[model samples]
Target: MRLFLLLFAAVFLPAMGSSKAVCHADVPCTLGDRSYHVRAPDDWDAATPMPVLLHFHGWGRQGDLIVNHGRIAGHTRNRGVLLLAPNGLGRSWDFWRAGSRDTDFALAVIEDAAKRYPIDRSRIYVSGYSYGSAMAWRFACEGGDGVAALLAISGTIPQDETCASHPRDIRHVHGLADPVLEYPFGPGGDPRGAVRLWRDTLGCGAGETAPDYAIRPFLTLSRTVWDSCAAGGRVTLDTHPGGHFIPHGWIGWQLDQLAGRAPRYP
Candidate 1:
């Protein structure tokens, strides 16, 4: 059984070099002692500015692991976006530590990608899972001015008193049965409280009583949205019946939202 699982991972996991080769070549950027990976769409040209996505991995994970197993590159393929995945200092990002270099590393990754690709400054976005999600929220709080949107999965926002004044689009996904990070508050923390925090910060009015609607085939999933917000902010929460995991369709849906396209799913 262990051998079979190994074979499965070997066959299914994407090769880091393969994705880099697809986009002409993968660009490796080093900041201090850490390095990050950057890949552009295969069909990209300098004719138009492309959107950028900065994805951070969960605890005990690195950029190569996400590039290989996270399915981020596969989802964004042909989507005309530059994808950047950065490694944390160790197994986790120092989200709560003041004077931490993680935030600076994130910003440096973005600036480096912009220098290499024609990135749409207004469409720069950040996303992550687990510990990385906390970093995403941290970025939204301290560096919201540079981020247009934030997508977090299986994690809660940090309890920070100071946050960016400008409103930005925010979306969170959490599972009620998440053994790692429970629904409202698991052993890690409460992701729903993070949602409420953003709602108040963005000045969002009362949201829908229930999910807007359910998506077919995913009975475990439901969504709540707060559209009436100040400073053009919008907040959304997606709940699921299972544990800490992100749906395969979420990346495409989020990309559509960033591109100003109507959601393809409920």
Candidate 2:
């Protein structure tokens, strides 16, 4: 019990001290028996109720390594919230197979984090890099209503009964030149088709056009929205022109939308 309190203090005290930290080593996380590397602003408070960003890294990247990359931490620091990067068992998220029970584990993390820090239940967001992106889509489709939003990067949603439920809060990001999940996948199953599935689920019109935005080196960001969703919510998509990588500023934009802040074009 004393060791647990000390661990809690190790986490709680730094935030109380107004310090920010991005951890790259195994540490006791909200999931008690499990420890994952996490990054966040030191000001995290359980009493202040802030938005939480649960970022799942791509295949082969450890949670601690993801934290070390500093992408998730850098995005949420200015907003004064928590950014958690939970390590997948074996460094891979098990979304397609049974007995994995990873979803329940993630849910536990959510409940645990809420108990440790001030979390706005209505503002919980999930994101992923690659394979993690696929898992994010799977979770959102299966149990998305509980979360405020989902941001999928560099991966496509898997074909499953989950998407049939028409999850309302989802934003897919993919590279136009991604060799892994090529664009415009149809009939036979393709990554682009997966996006179309979520797009259709969100009730977007087939004729809807994408927004115009400036192009980046090896990447171009495009946004589109579905109209008149049944849940009174909408779905958005951001397409880029690069390979398999988390597009810059995509996370920040989602956070802004979650925070009720209007988006600004770069």
Top model number, lDDT = 1
Which residue segments of model 1 deviate by more than 4 Å?
1-27, 97-99, 165-167, 185-192, 209-219, 262-266
**Taking the tens digit of each residue's C-alpha lDDT, what string does model 1 give over 136-219?**
777777676878888888876544355654327888887778898656552356444548768778778877645434334654
1-266 per-residue lDDT for model 2 (tens digits): 65665566455643442333423235535355665555555444435777777877778876776555545665676666677777787788887743346666777767765545567777888888888887777667666678778888877654434353434477787777888756545576543454666655665554344765643344567666665564456677677667777666667767776677874322
Which 10-residue window of candidate 2 scores lowest in summed lDDT? 16-25
TM-score of every model versus the real structure: 0.80, 0.79
Model 1 TM-score on a 0 to 1 scale = 0.80
Candidate maximizing TM-score: 1
lDDT of 2 at 171: 79
> Candidate 2: TM-score?
0.79
